[model samples]
Target: MKKYLLLSAFATLTLLSCNNEGTSVNNTVESMKTPAMENFDKAFKSLGDPQNRPTEEEKKRNTSELSDRRKALLVPASKELILSLGVTESELMRKTGGDMSQIIVWATQIYMKKSDEIRKNIKSEK
Candidate 1:
């Protein structure tokens, strides 16, 4: 009877823990978002949309047009912020090779680090 009681308690706790996992994950993700993430999301969205993608025909026949399109993928705000951080536009374009995902990753890392510094300074000032 004691063994049976312990088993049921363990099973109940396990089930309750499982139910909390989804909420915990969502809360964590929500808390992690910052204004800098907006730029990352915008670039990612433009890259992810099929309609915004360069066609295979364009890749083959109109490489210059494709390059221009890829360059344009970086929104002006993002471009300005990234450039202000001392990363040259050409260097970023070369590093990302027109991959928005890469740019998103790079920009998010830069922004998050800078944001952390700003927060630290604000707290220290207080």
Candidate 2:
């Protein structure tokens, strides 16, 4: 009876430890967002603001075009995100031709690539 009790206690401890390990890994991934990732997330999320969203008329007018006002809203955050990724102002201008949309797109691509690399590293570590 004592041996059976000891085995049950050991099994409980082993299961608890395994559960804690999974939670810790999830916590690590959640905490691993770099500043650049934060900035990129912020820049994209800005468009979800009511003031930033295009009205029906505006959308009908030109679905492909972002108005100057909308561009104004995105430019600062987008520039910050791009610069955080080690891109110089001159290099950004040369690469994006001073287009706010292009800057955002380029930054998003970089963000996705970096995110993929992080995920790959985490998977490999496990």
Best by TM-score: 2
Identify the candidate with maximal lDDT.
2
lDDT of 1 at 38: 54
What is each predicted model's overall lDDT from 0 to 1? 0.66, 0.80
Task: Please report how far candidate 2 places residue 94 from its true position, in Å.
Answer: 1.4
Which pairs of residues collide in candidate 1?
A: none
lDDT of 1 by residue, 29-98 (tens): 5455454455655665786689778778667785443344654665454555566667887998998785
Candidate 1 segments exceeding 4 Å error? 1-16, 61-66, 80-126
Estimate candidate 2's alpha-carbon lDDT, on a 0 to 1 scale: 0.80
How well does candidate 2 match the true structure in TM-score terms? 0.69
- Judge candidate 2 at residue 12 and give its lDDT: 100
